[model samples]
Target: MSDRLVIENLQVSYGSGAQRVEAVAPMSLAVPAGQKLGIVGESGSGKSTLLKAVLGLIRPPGVVRADGIWLDGTDLRSLSRREFRARCGSEIAMIFQDPVNALNPAFSIRDQFRRSFRLHQPDLPRSRYTETMLRALASVSIDARDKLGRYPFEFSQGQLQRIMIALACSSPRLKVLLADEPTSSLDVTTQAQVLDLLHALQAELGFSLIIVTHNLPVVAELCDRALVMCRGEVVEDTDVISLFEQPTHDYTRHLLASMASLPRIASGAAS
Candidate 1:
């Protein structure tokens, strides 16, 4: 299959001159259609910055410069901000790390879904919208009728994450899912459940995935290929099995060693 997303010489920097800092050095990557790729890095390794740049979310004083960012043959950099926002969730959706903070505390679940639908499917009738929302929730094993009236604070973290997943996948135009540290805040069993849900949804929907995380086990479980980044640059790129079995970069080896020292916990195990 053709590449679903392609990024070339992507760079991000904050501030000017004396105060400037490079958050992400020049880098290039490609994600083929329906493939899952993991980006593993420590906290300051520019993983989040890279994701933000790709999403066109970088604010003033934080500059994003790239030779090209193409999504299925369309050049993203050429699109206006309004054009980008229109395409964002439908063409490329993002699932943030903190579901609670990502959601509006004052809005009910149905309200949130309505806002999303407005952006992507403004002409959709009310009945159709409700039906679509309910079906999306059901895909993640959530009961829309019972949960739609509740605020973000009412649900457990795991449920909120599942809801976010549902929202991301609801659009028929969705081609790529960008997940940034998506399972970091959840408990062990909930983390496993979310991962399983992501895998199942990807299988059923056929969207490409780019998961940004520091967790090696998460990558191993869900990704076929992995990229290891350190100090604002990609140090290694290899298939998931080879990354763990014979990491070439020193930093990759260190990361593997760190993971090795942690206690082994099976997926879905009680915390």
Candidate 2:
């Protein structure tokens, strides 16, 4: 498969002087079409910052300097702000963590769905737009007629996550899904279910995925290739099975050991 996303010599930094910090090093990575790539590290390891740099969402004083970000050979960093935003929801969308915070509380599900639909299909008739919204909801196995009329609070976290996924997949312009700690908030069973859905969607939509998470089991189940990050640099890039079987980096081995030592959810929580 051809490369759908590419990054070379990517860097992100914050502040100056002795306090200066480099959040990401000269990192180079790529995601080909229909590929699932995992970036795993502990909290504050620059995983989120890396995704922000790609989206051009890094804030002031948090500088992101990169050599190239090519989407199907088109340099994304070269696009104007308007051009980038125009391409964002349509071309590359992100399913952020915390769907509750990410969504507007006041807007009903239907309204939000319609607004998102109109962003990409502005010329479609009202009836067609409604149809599209229902189709999108149904794609994620949501009951559009009943659920679309309800507020975000009416749904469970897992359901809201699926809604976010549906919204991201609504438009045909979406080529990639940037999943950041997507299943972190859910229980193991729910996490497994959502991950299954994510895998199915990737297969159905033929879109590439770049998932950032701390969950080793998630990485093992979801990703084909794994890139282990530590201290703002990629320490290991290998197949998931190989990395899990024999982690080379000291940090990678430590991470695997740490996850291995985590108590069972029920036992840990009961304590």
Candidate 3:
């Protein structure tokens, strides 16, 4: 199958001349249709910047330049902001790290779903909206009928994340899902649940996934291929099994070592 997404020599920079700083150095990668790819990096390692560039979310003073960012056979940079926004929920969707911040506290779950539905399918009959919302929630194993009237603060963190996933996956045109540190804030059990939900949804919906995270275990569990970033560059790109068995880059080895030592350090401290 052809690649679903291809980014070539993409670069993102802020400011100009003496004050300029590159958030994402020129880098490139591709995701095959229905593949699960993970980008692993520390904070400020340019993972988020890469995602923002792909989404056209970078504001002025922060310039995003690329040879090409192709979705299917289309180059996304050719599209205007309005045109891109129109394609957001259906063509490409993002699930942010913090679900609470992504949601409006004042709006009920039903209202949130309505806004999302309208954004992607504005001409659809209002009568079908409720059923759509219910199905979306059910896909993530949430009780939509009981929770639709509740506000954002009414649900637990895990539930909120599931809702965010539901919202992103609801559109029929959704072919790719970009998740940014989605499980970072949840407890271990909740993290596992969310990961399982993500995998199940991906299997059922057949959307390609690009997950950005610092958590190695999460990547190992959810991704087939892994890209390790350091100092705004992709230092290592390999299959998840190879990444663990033999990391080529010194930085990648260090990261793996750090993760490995954490449990021992905690045990020593406790004893």
- Those runs of model 3 whose alpha carbons end farther than 4 Å from true positions after fitting are 263-271
- Candidate 2 backbone collisions, by pair: 90-173
Candidate-wise lDDT, in order: 0.90, 0.84, 0.87
Where does candidate 2 stray beyond 4 Å?
123-125, 263-271
Give per-residue CA lDDT, model 1, range 57-84, as digits (tens): 8998999999999999888999987777
lDDT of 2: 0.84
- In the order shown, the candidates' Cα RMSDs to the true structure are 2.0, 3.6, 4.0
The superposed Cα distance between candidate 2 and the true structure at residue 43, in angstroms, equals 0.8
Error of 2 at 109 (Å): 1.1
Please identify model 1 stretches exceeding 4 Å from their true place: 265-271
Return the top candidate by lDDT.
1
How well does candidate 3 match the true structure in TM-score terms?
0.93
Can you give the TM-score per candidate against the true fold? 0.95, 0.92, 0.93
Give the per-residue lDDT digits (tens) of candidate 3, residues 81-145. Answer: 76777787888999999999999999999999998877787766899999999999999999778
Residue range 1-271, candidate 2, lDDT tens digits: 7899999899999998897889999899888888888999988888999888888889978988888998888889998876776777777888888888877889989988888766655656787876788888888888778667789998899889998998888878678889998888888767777787888888889888899987777777778899988878999999999998989999999999999987433222111
Indicate which candidate wins on TM-score: 1
**Model 3: lDDT to the true structure:** 0.87
**Sorted by TM-score, highest first, which candidate order results?**
1, 3, 2
